[model samples]
Target: MTERPVTQFGPDFPFAHDDWIRHPSGLGAIPTDSHGASVAVIGAGLSGLVAAYELMKLGLRPILFESGQLGGRLRSQPFEGADDVVAELGGMRFPVSGTGFYHYADLLGLETKPFPNPLTEAAGSTVIDLEGETFYAKSLGDLPSVFQEVAKAYDEALESGANYSALKQAIRTRDKARIKEIWNPIVQAWDERTFYDFVTSSPAFQRLSFRHREVFGQVGFGTGGWDSDFPNSMLEILRVNVTECDDRQRFFVGGVERLPQGLWRRAPDRMVHWPKGTSLQSLNGGALRPGASAIRRLPDGKVAVRDRWGREDVFDAVIATCQSWLLTTAIDTEESLFSQKLWMALDRTRYMQSSKTFVMVDRPFWKDVDPRTGRDAMSMTLTDRLTRGTYLFDNGPDRPGVICLTYSWMSDALKMLPLPVERRVELALSALEKIYPGLDIAGHVLGDPITVSWEDDPNFLGAFKGALPGHYRYNHRMYGHFMQENLPPSERGIFLAGDDISWTPAWAEGAVQTALNAVWGVMTHLGGRSHADNPGPGDAYPEWGPVALPD
Candidate 1:
């Protein structure tokens, strides 16, 4: 057996064991006294997988169900001609802000590479076209001539309530003139002639609203809000929190998926292995059975799930790590307060429609010119381009630079895009050349760009989940509100475990933190009074979380 790498955040790491004791819920003892039955984790995404793995450490057994491949969105593809030029489609490039995830990776022996931040693969000679004129704003001194005007406008725009239009539409309108007076100020902010002005209000801010002039208006920048925007000062704070004080911009030497792979590796044998590529036909009401424990309840009774081959099994309990859309379409129809409330909560929230484009080529196709020291090599692009995403890394010296392009596209185009595997690849490749000009496409286009537009998948329905301006602060959870309360007082059999439930949604870090919470709950429940008021564990390397969500 390979010697386990000296873990930076292992159990023996300083204050490791103490962290488990400090959680509000206790470090769980196995549930030998309570029920002594097995627990099942639904979905093999990062959270579900980690929770099951952690439970087994306390001597409780867990089963994981994955309708698709494990790793949720840690997607990878093998390039034919390039030497080890693998491409990642989704969930690539975790920042220094991934605090707990960093700890998890260190323990798993995964090596993280401090890759610089650039908006795309084309490093040098990159241009931002606006008003038919282009500018290259790579360095600090390269600020565009109109940067100051943009700065003031951007400040007003940000300070404005974020969704001023939506908030304006929902305000109390008892008085007509009063309503108009209230709205006039907000209208001036949102309709500064166009959303374009609102975004480009700042020179450094154009990309925040996806106003890059390279492509037509149909395309845009990374679709997420500025709350988690790259290059923001927020990342500096996040890096301090997620990583040790020494860490900075990094991409896992192998790939971003290695972070999850690392966390998965730290898990015991019981968790490292699971049933993969198995389809879940239906889940019966595990929670509603006669005298059944609370954890096992399904919506109506308990979910009775059938496999793709139509084999059926209704377990005593289930751990659902599903995204919002999955519950609406794939779940079996029984009925229960939990399921009804859960679906309703999801129904109330709005999710962004996304289209992801991953372009993997044969070699270091783009010319890299470093401006810091007048060198001709830099593996990052932070441009404000339409139809572009963050991250361009040296996939390997063999392939040079295998670029992964991600864009948050409109979800309504689920029909505008192709459904079949072959068609999907063709569409992605065509989209790639359209964004990057003068790149020899004759044979340079290796295979095809892999597109993962989650809006259509019956299993996930959409990407993990999204949070609007005030959504993060207003409500702890946009979709999973009911489950938050369903956890028993001091003892919860059913715990909400997933990346979507935490602050850093849609990443392995959030998922792992949720797992740590579940393990804490389980240990507390099994130990009875022995483990009371204990501060639970963290994502293995140990980032922090609120014991309870804000009301």
Candidate 2:
């Protein structure tokens, strides 16, 4: 193992997994007699599961309420009759930089392989289609000179406008002070600007033709086309890049859903209220309570939650891990549960539309050498056509392979919102048919295709929050909710936890980090104190909290 550096956050501020289990969580233990104290946890996603697991270890009973499946956005759907073949409907790639999330993945013994990102080795080969032209490449060097120029311009802009290198170094070293110093300035400058504004405004891009910008929008670096994110806050894009959220990406071997499912049945080495063999699955008697329909604060300083089936339960505290909008739409929540300022933040949270259509093939035919060109039969594709990004997942030589025919966002996704799964698949194939003229893509398809339009799903109105320009104040209010020391007692117990509440919105690491924050908040609320040696998030919040919004 590499020597873990002791940073200002004590080797754990960013990840926190090591500190959580290495020593006694500095939380004051719950009273032995009060081990039966029950806490209501809204949503059974990664955030809620983690918070419940930790709280259970600390002797508090947690009753989970989930409107959807347990994994939340980590939806992994296996193809019919091919259990080994799965399509990741949401959150396919995960960066290794998300060490907090990796801690759980490692603990669960889940296997992962490098994701086939564009221009990466795992992709084998890449095909770029734009303006009635197609370019095939083994690497970026293989692309045309114009594409190379665009990539270079993007790098130059980041260095000149965002101090990319310095910021990366600060984050890599976990130097909170240095990170804040570098990040706060960029946030102030870019928070109110759109990503397109930053790119087009750059002198590097201006030196080239408008076509360069067009190609950059269709085949951006790290991931794929970023044109869909053009209207989002520049800060959102910068956060993803500087934090390495787009680098060294990997996907779970069987399914990304394993992380949350594993935690549901995992038995910690030590626990307070339950026995050594106790698991969340066993504690809940094998099923989660139905989705929460209503939540109200009782006069006795407790929380009352009613499920869709009208099953009501009262608890000393509540941890709502669902999307913010659900608090208003799906669940009838009391107005007093949150301050008006908080409600504004929650109501204004903007979720991006996303759609993905996938199909399973008999084999990884893309690996076959083409008799004519001596290249792979097919390559991971990026096109300005209707299909923006296409991914190929090779299960194995014998098992069926999965192909994400079309993965689009925003306007691109909304265009297919009303279409059926079959029609969506047809449209994607029609676009791809134009790119790979003679490739028998249809003949290779083995089973029915699966499709998802996140915006159409009531549980999650959209894929993830894409903060618009000038929305940092709202985000600041939401992210700072766990720090309720100054808030009234009525607002103290019902805490919020989810990726949307984090600075880096779409990543699982954000969910894990924010869940830890709620864990600390709940512990403190229950009169538990952090152990003197291993301080919780609240104990160390002032010294290493999120970068504050600049004036």
Candidate 3:
């Protein structure tokens, strides 16, 4: 079957740059530095790569260092050909919301596509009842009402009988506008606050609204799984920023990794220190993986590195452009003064237990794969009552008989199960076959399973830290937290970057911000003029939403 490109919607929404993107463009102010400057970027994931790419634009020859392949969360495991269009084992699917990510992808030149039909047409099924060892095939669009129905029953219990309103302010309006004014605000809040807390706390839940229970009805609504103690408020933040789209709507074009892939191909020469399997011991005073003396920080600051027992080189300035947790841990005491404070911020953080399950199917689940990627991992929630899988995606292959596998995210109770790799694979395959009944998913031959446990990966304990209730206003202040304090350009040389420092929390978007922050930090530090002045200081993702109520 021939593939057709789906139309994209509002900017930062989906199918980015498809004339539908509505978010504002421009990086808000990341100026280029003087000519021929040296820079070192640590961590080769989206954040590190973006930082390096941005540095190149700034006239600084930037070098990127990593212990693994590029794309950190955005990377995949081919287990085969270099360009066999590797299957994504990491980040997948972009939410219509999450403006920062959308904004960053567009800037880097990635395209978006529309969603699929029957919805289940993409994948024969979407639900796997692992708890009961059952399979549930259904469209997620039906979710909103599903939860509403369940909430209706829960509402009755919360109403306190006659003259009793579960809503805190004693108000109720189903109107979208009314909902936006009243309910939407509530939704936004609950979304960011943490579902567990909101479930346990929100007066609204006690008062119950149609939206409250409906959230769980939606696939990811109870995303962390209704069983989770974590709050939905944080997820709500990502939701609030997302653009709402119609059902049978998704996208993918010329391959989903186009943007990041392009950035790499376009500036391959600029990327340095891209070593595979050469893990670091620690970082300090502008140096990476101290010990063995395989690292060289040249007089100009261009980091020259070798494998575990390789060679050496130099670099001018080092842009710690990965996750703050990794960078902070690697940094030795003295040189890393803010370690304690940064560690505090990290400590205050929380994250959902999520895992990615990449499956190579025999054909396009839908007529086409969505161009955007994020939140495709399989998940389970309450009201919406999903069976645990949260998302799915394409393998980026164009062959006719190819089974472009999808990466599903499992959070909540499902993530807690400490099963072995073989057992996990069997469980995932069983789940896939059950939910996607009638599909030749299991029959599809070839390829051993390749998975990365971000939820368990030692370097990163979670798939990026989550901001807890009331953790904001200062959360991004720490991780991905950008401080515009000015210093001479030279003094700004040691720049701290990474998605954690950029407020986007472990996503590519945050990485871009960190790059801008680090370089901008350097500019201000140098006393030299930069492209755009600090609009002030602090994290950038929007903050106005209210706590979320479990749907």
Candidate 4:
């Protein structure tokens, strides 16, 4: 028998969202009366666009509201005077395990290439600098024995602490019962514990020195340093590993922004109640409406969404796809729209800080090899310094190259948040110069640098959600709210979707999955039902939903 490949089947929900979206029978059918119903989708990000697109396919009209850039955090800022050359300031890497997200990417027929992650073949060479020491390697085998020991200890920790192999096997085979059997207990045990707690308490790490722990954080098992996430929930880290969200990563060719923008302009080959040439762009009259400033439920049971300009429109349903905090901060959402418990969940949901600095260069000079040393001019770098992780993008020999000088999180991100873009580049260059002495990186730079601090923007206070210890119930409340059967009539029409509303918060797959959930929620709310052969998340939610804990 062929072994089933692993995708983002939830340890929490365990629904095959990838399978659900790709079903030949279609998502669902709306009632004839609700065919042209107006559904307000707030925010023009991945989640909002996806919900809008799917709802349009189901024969409903989706009105999108945008306050900032259309792509939201999937921004790909192009350098001046450069053709198709871009800096992926946010959400650059996509792992193969994220089948739910790739379903849409594939639908758009976007081209992708393997990302240049450290220690991977795509990077060609990786440079590891820690505690003022430098080491270069082509693979993990070339690193020192300490790295091997750290890697092995992490593996053992997973096996001894989390039943790594069996649990992953369950996920790969799509065994919902077995997955919940193994996962629910771990959630109970680790929900209140931090990632650092899991590492220090584990027998494997206890056998090793604290230096091993530091090395493990500075140069993590996959990608790069994960010390920033050490303060997050152990459940969060475990989700990233078990689901392979950090493995076999790839990036969209032109830019990741293409996915959402393409979906916006794309006209589905088959759609109901609309003309052959209809599209979200055409439906909205070639542009998105202004940002939503307020949401209020009408006496007639319909919802009124008011734009920043004070123009109000009534809709049968509204899907809030913006950052959960925006509900309290940016949007004047009615208190009666959600229960106090859910509002607590939404209000308390924590978001992490992230910053990226990128510069376009004259060419991919880093790929050039020096005659004296058998090494390339520069390699993909990981360090414990302020720069954190530096990535290189080679468009082609004849085209301009792009370099992400620093991709930092939390404190590291905060350090760069106040600095100007020029200073950010100078500091990154200063850090790298020490690692590669005499390397003139400044000489190869060209055009102006582009940087982003997600928290600095009013639209998005942070890059993505980072659930803390003891937040599982909060996550459950927000994620399961789409199945609104028992909710009072007052709150039934308003729904939520986004990465923040998902179990795996930092991943685009989470955004895609939750968006599909809102589609299911909106359809069912309007007296529609999924095809019997192709049940939606809400259909299987009752039997395979996330486990709930005591209040």
Pick by lDDT: which candidate is best? 4
Over 4 Å off in model 2, which ranges? 1-18, 21-28, 547-551
Model 1 lDDT tens row, 1-551? 65322211211112233245334453545444543345666666677766665565455545565677666677655555555456665565565544555655665677766544432322332334334454454532354644433444444444443433332232212222433343334433332133444344534465444433223232222222232222122212221222222224455665556544444445333321223321111111211111111222444443455544555555444566656445445555333424443545555444445565555655564444445635333223333343334345555546545655545544333543466645544543454444444345335446655566766665565565554432332224322231333443322344456766654455565566566656555545444323544434422223322222233
Candidate 4 local lDDT, 342-448, one digit each (tens): 99999999999999999889899989997778898899999999999999999999998999999999999999999999999999999999998888888988989
lDDT of 2 at 231: 91
TM-scores for all predictions:
0.64, 0.96, 0.62, 0.99
Candidate rank order under lDDT:
4, 2, 1, 3
Residue range 360-432, candidate 3, lDDT tens digits: 4444434432345222223221122222443444444454223322222345334434755555566655555
Off by over 4 Å in 1: 1-26, 31-36, 81-84, 119-126, 147-249, 259-316, 337-340, 368-386, 411-416, 419-437, 441-443, 468-492, 525-534, 537-551
Q: On a 0 to 1 TM-score scale, where does candidate 2 land against the true structure?
A: 0.96
lDDT of 2: 0.86
Q: Which ten residues in a row have the lowest lDDT in candidate 2?
A: 4-13
Weakest 10 consecutive residues of candidate 1 by summed lDDT: 279-288
Q: Provide the clash count, candidate 4.
A: 0
RMSD of each: 11.5, 2.4, 10.4, 0.8
lDDT of 2 by residue, 1-551 (tens): 67433221221134354456456553457667668688899999899998888888888888999888999999899999997588999899999877778878998899999999999999999999998799999999999999899999999989988988877777666766777777777877888999999999998998889889988888998899888889999988888887788888999998999999999999988788688888888888789999999999889999999999998989988999999999999999999989999999999999999999999999999999999988888899999888899999998899899999999999999999999999998899999989988998989998789999999888999999999999888888887788888999778799999999887888998888788888888887777777787777777777766556654
Which scores greater on lDDT, model 3 or model 4?
A: 4
Identify the superior model by TM-score, candidate 3 or candidate 4. 4
Decoy 1 TM-score against native: 0.64
Q: Rate the local accuracy (lDDT) of all candidates.
A: 0.45, 0.86, 0.43, 0.93
